[model samples]
Target: MKKIALAFLCFLATDSMAQVSQDSTISAKEEIEIIEKDTLFIDMAKYKLTIPNNWKIKAGCTEEQCTANSPQDTLGGFDTYIESINITVNKLSSSSYTAEKYANFSIGYLPKVVKGFKVLEKKRLNSYSYRVTYTGSKNNIEQTWRQYYHVRSSKVYIITFSAQARKYDHYQPIMEPYLASFKFK
Candidate 1:
């Protein structure tokens, strides 16, 4: 009787341990699914790549063309800058440019403060175009603000997130999925 009771107690303990382990695995998988759900989706069914979240949309134009050059106050207290997503479709034949080419193109068009950035990740969406992320400077002057760009379907998305020099550590997790979330309608 004593031997049977002892064996039964051992079995119960082992079963409980196994149940806890399974529960942990399920929880982890669920967490991953939730993160995937948070991804931004662009509705580019019309002809343009859809803009994702955390991005402020505006009309693309030269600073001189824009009437409000200053950042506007918002409820969040972080003023929104006057800039544009600046989509130009059918302008170029096809974006056969390499990741380096795109990075060079960015440095060429952006302000001088953007000394030069390195490509962290690049995802080729199709034969013609690619999405890229890089760490550039906003004038490593005063404070070296970090910037990232996501180019897709002839449209470029630029983001100036923070001034941390460890730009990759800060932006990689957020930028990777954001870039991956892009789909051609």
Candidate 2:
């Protein structure tokens, strides 16, 4: 019994010592706060797009936003060869914005954008309320893909992912995971 008690006391002392050592390693210079991943992240709410992780969030047209700094304009003979994510939120009382509306906007912009592009696939997440996904092509040769997600309650949340027709296949896998991670509470 005496030996057992001695061993137990030693184990406790060792455990306490280990904890003290760990506590000491956390210096005052280091931030003590835990940095949690942003679950309610929206790069741009109005555009219904998400800001890619690599892309820094810059001041957008609205108070809540960010945009790619590449300054890409499809009108400049630039083929629509890009991938993008978008998100937006609206009030429950507001008019419903469907995935088709966004697709129409893309169609409208495509004329101003790359000259020959048509939508390919457009999907809406029924579980996510107003979420939508769209894939299209440029001149039937270059394919593009887009995804949109929205929430309807007090406010609507929209999230979109887009890529050029040619690059859609390549970027699909990369963006799909991030798209899957989208959730708002």
User: Whole-model lDDT for model 1 versus the true structure?
Assistant: 0.37
Which residue pairs collide, candidate 1?
none
Worst 10 residues of 1 by lDDT: 62-71
Superposition-based RMSD of candidate 2 using all C-alpha atoms, in angstroms: 18.0
lDDT per residue for candidate 2 within 1-185, as digits (tens), equals 53453344334333433221112133323312211221113322222222222332323334123223212334337754444554444455435655445445545666555445445555655744433334444454444545454544445444556555555564555455456655553
Name the best candidate (by lDDT): 2
lDDT of each: 0.37, 0.42
Q: What is the TM-score of each candidate against the true structure?
A: 0.39, 0.45
Candidate 1's residue-wise lDDT over 1-185, tens digit each? 53453344334333333221112123435544634643222232332222222333333322112111112324235633322223323222356544345545655665444556454555555544555444555534222222334445554444333323443353334333433433444
Best by TM-score: 2
